[model samples]
Target: MELKLPEIPELSRQHRLAAQEQLDRKTKPVGSLGRLEELAVQLCAIQHKVPPDTARKRILVFAADHGITEEKVSAYPREVTAQMLANFAAGGAAINVLARLMGGELFVVDVGVAAEPVVGVKNRKVRWGTRNFAHEPAMTVEETLQALNVGIELAFEAAEDEVDILCLGEMGIGNTTAAAALLCLLTEAREEQVVGRGTGLTDAQLEHKRAIVARAVARHREWVKTPFEALCAVGGLEIAALVGSMIGAAASKIPVIVDGFIVTVAALVAYHLTPKARDALIFAHRSEELGHRYALELLEANPLLDLGMRLGEGSGAALASFLVEAAGRILREMATFAEAGVSEREEQDVT
Candidate 1:
């Protein structure tokens, strides 16, 4: 299938200016809210309004299996990917608990589990699992496009449901290896700079993991001509879908709260694919994963929190949704200086 991506417009400077002006006039000292004020302004710019409504939030967790797990990069077995999809459908996963507490609906999407079908999961599998990149490319260009279009369709579906905020998460064993490889390919960084001990690997396992990434990068060095091409070479199916989801959300004017390292890899793909998508993304938190900070720095993203978290499954994003809501409420409900009948400081001229 030929994929046509939605066109994401640039952030509205006019709305950003309006949000800032309103925030300054609130019943507080100028710039008192600090990052919260910045968050509000960015939300306004993304939504093309002074105060962007953040009421209806949705979290989509894309679950798949990576053939690279055959390389023993991750401590967990690839079977866990399909098992966790069942856990998600049963509302027993960490994302499930957090999403319920945060009052956001969670959806488990099976992009490529490489296992038996799980009941109650959205089945959009492109393949059983991606090919092992150590031996060959992870996926073909055609399969990559199919996975991406599934994400595009999901984004439009969320828009139709009136979702105002979207949070992205992923599940796949050895995905950290895939994410690390992608970071190296996209940033031309050394494997040491991007590889990390995923799932509590010992020192020896970490080294072995780095070696696998290096081998994959060396094999596909010539084929990685574009972000999508890089994804096809070393990325997971869920990661490609995430790239499409981010693009679609930006096009639909919905704010996207990105989770940890794996999700940031996808965010990098989307940002590289369309620079305008950055305006619609809200980096939820910094992950403890090895290359997460490097990826965020590449995007110039200032996340809302950092709690030494390395867990994926959108757990961080679900917790950070409250902060986004708080920012919106501050913009909409806080009283103006005049409304509060408060005394104002006299304007002083610098000139």
Candidate 2:
């Protein structure tokens, strides 16, 4: 199947200027709120509204298993992917708690978990699991397109439901190895720069994981020219879904709060496919993963938080939603200097 991507429209510069003017008039000195002001402007530009809608947030967790776990790349067992889906359904996971606290509806999507159908999770499985990229391509081009379409469908559904924002995350064993391999391929970084100790791998295990990434990248480098080709080579099904979701959200004019490392890799692919998609992305936080900084730099993104978070279940995005909401509220609800009769900053005459 030929994959058809949606056309991602650029954010409105007119709305951006309007948002900035409003922020400057908000009684605080210009840019006093710093990144908050920048975020508000971006939100306005994406939505083409003076104040973007920041309510009705949705958190989508894409769960799958990577066959690369066979390489002993991660500390956790592969079955943990299915077990964690059950935990998510039971509201016992950290993301469950965080989503509830942040007033965001959480949905778990089973794209390619190795287990049977998981109860209470969306069954959109493209396959049982991706093939081990250490030996060959992780997914066929057709399977990759299927996984991407599943995410696009979900994101379109969110847009129809009037969801104001989408927060992306993933659950998969040995996915860090896949993400690291993708980072090296996408950003032209070395394995040592992109690989990290996923799930607390020991020093020796981390080195082994790095070696696996190097080998995988070396095996697939020539054919992995496009971002889609790179994804087909070594990306996880959930990661492919993430790339689709970002593109789908952009096409629907919805902003996405991107989570750490793994999701950032997805965003990188999305950006590569549709550079205008970056206009709708709000990076949530920096991860403790070694490659996250490099990925962020490649995307020219400055994340909203950096609390040493490596947990990739949208925890950081959930937390950052509060700040996103606050930024919107500041734009919409704050009294302007003239409205509040506040003295404006004096312009210093230098002539």
Per-residue lDDT tens digits of candidate 1, residues 115-174? 977998999999999999998999998999989988888998999999989999999998
Consecutive 10-residue window with the lowest summed lDDT within model 1: 1-10
Model 1 alpha-carbon drift over 4 Å, by segment: 1-3, 348-351
Q: What is the C-alpha RMSD of each candidate to the true structure, in Å?
A: 1.5, 1.3
Q: Any residue pairs clashing in model 1, and if so which? A: none
Q: lDDT of candidate 1 vs native?
A: 0.91
Query: Which model scores highest in lDDT?
Result: 2
* Model 2 C-alpha lDDT per residue in residues 204-286, reported as the tens digit of each score: 99989988888889889977778889999999999999999999999998999999999999999998888988889999999
